[model samples]
Target: MAIDSDYTVNSGVTTGVIGMQDPLYLAPGDISGLNPVASPFNDKHYLKWSRAVKMALISMNKVGFITGKYPKPAEIAATYQDWIKADYNVMCWILHSMIPEISESLLYVQSSKQLWDEIKDRYNQANAPFLYQLRKDVMHTIQENNQSVVNYFGKLTSV
Candidate 1:
C-alpha cells in the first residue's frame, strides 16, 4: 500500500483524508509584535515589561525555546535540519522584538535560553526596598472623595 500525506487509516482500511497542520508552525502576525512599554532602567517598568513580554512569549508557544525546556527533534529524522532552521528564525524574531538596548546586547548570543537567562539575571533581582514601597503604596491607596469606585479600584490594582 502507498501512503500519502492526506491519508488516514480507519479500522484496517485507509479511509478519510486527514489534513494535519504543523503545530510548530507560526504564521506572521498571529500575535502582535511586542514593543517595550517601559524602560528596563526603571525598576517598576522593568517588571511590567518583563511580564508583558513573558505573556506574549507564552501565547506564541515559543517560550520553551528560550527556557531550554522544548524538545529536540530526533537526529535521524529527515526534517531535523529544517526544524532547527525554522526554530532559529522564530527565536531571532522574538529576540529582536525586545527593546534595542536589551536586544543589541543579545545579538551575539546564539542560544535563546542564554539570551533569556542573561536578561532575567540582570533585571529580575530581588529588591526588598522596592517591594516594600510597592506594598506601602497599595496599602495606603484609598478611594478619593471625587474618584469613582471603578477608577479607584483600577488604581489600586495597578500599584
Candidate 2:
C-alpha cells in the first residue's frame, strides 16, 4: 500500500527559507498581543505560521491599499509593519475632530471647490447635538456609554 500523506501536516514547509533551522510552529499572530494562543503543530518550535502569513500580507498594503511590486514566488516572508487596523476605521471620526490624514502630495491635488466640499461635508455631517457625539465615540463605546453629552451641548447652544 502507498503510504498516506497528510496535506495538513506539510502546509508550513516553504522553499528558499534560510535560518529556518527550527520549523516554524507558533504563527506571528498566536504569539502577538497580551494573551497568546498556540497552534497544535508548531507550538514547540516558534511563532504560528498562519499569523506570520497574515502579518506579511498586512505589510503589503496601507489601509488594505497595496502599492508595491509583487515579489517573485520564492521570496521569504517579511515581518508586517502596520498601525492598528482599527485606526483606519476611525478615519471619519478623527477627521471630524479637525484631524485629517492628508499627506503633502494629496493636499496639493485638490481644487478649491473640492477642498470646500470636503470641509463642508465633514463639519456639517450632523446637527450640533450629533456633532458632539463623535467626540465621545472612543470613551462611550469603550466604557460608561452615554448620550448625555449631546443633551448638555444642546442645552448650551440652544440649536
Candidate 3:
C-alpha cells in the first residue's frame, strides 16, 4: 500500500487526516447588520446591550475578533488578508449594533478589539456620578394614579 495525502496505516490501524481552512469564512449575508443586539447601544444600556452583542458574536464564532484571541498576523503572512477581512466583518457587526453617533465616532478604528476596548472603557466604567444618578432616580420615583401597584413596583425595581 502507498501513502499519499490521504490516510496512513500504523500497527494495522488506519488513521485519516483532514485539512481545514480558517473558521472565519464570512457568508454574503454576514456582510451587513448581524442583528447582534436588537436595540442599538445608546451608552445607557451597556450591561444589557453588551450581553446581547456577546451572545450574537458567540453564535457566529467571531467573539475572538473582539477579545484579541485571534491576533492580527504580519502583513507578509499568508493568513493576514483573511484575518483582516474577518476582522472588518466583526467590526461592522459591532458598529451596526450601535447608534450612528457612537459608531461614527469609532469609524477610523483599525481593529475590532480596539473598538471593543474603547466602547467598554467609555461605557462599562463604574463611576460615582452614574451611581449618584441612579440613587437620585430611585429616590424621586412616584407612582402615577393611573398605574397599577404591581406596575409601579416594577418601575421602582427596574431603576
Q: What does each candidate score in C-alpha RMSD?
A: 7.0, 19.0, 7.8
The C-alpha TM-scores of every prediction are: 0.62, 0.18, 0.70
Best by lDDT: 3
What is the Å distance of residue 65 in model 3 from its true position?
0.7
Minimal lDDT window, size 10, model 1: 34-43
Q: Give the TM-score of candidate 2.
A: 0.18
On TM-score, the leading prediction is 3
Model 2 C-alpha RMSD vs. true structure (Å) is 19.0
Candidate 2 wrongly placed segments (more than 4 Å): 1-109, 127-155
lDDT of 2 by residue, 79-119 (tens): 11111222222222212222134322224422222332344
User: Model 2 scores what on Cα lDDT?
Assistant: 0.29
The residue-by-residue lDDT of candidate 1 on 10-119, one tens digit each, is 77675433222442445565433334233333334556776766666666655666666654556654344544654565456556556566667767865566666777
Question: How are the candidates ranked when ordered by TM-score, highest leading?
Answer: 3, 1, 2
Stretches of candidate 1 off by over 4 Å are: 1-23, 30-46, 71-77
Of 1 and 2, the candidate ranking higher by lDDT:
1
lDDT of 3 by residue, 1-159 (tens): 111234456997755442232335566677655657778998886887888988988877778889988888778544566678888999999999989999999999999999999999889989898889999999999999999999999999878
What's the residue-level lDDT of 97 in candidate 3? Answer: 93
TM-score of 3: 0.70
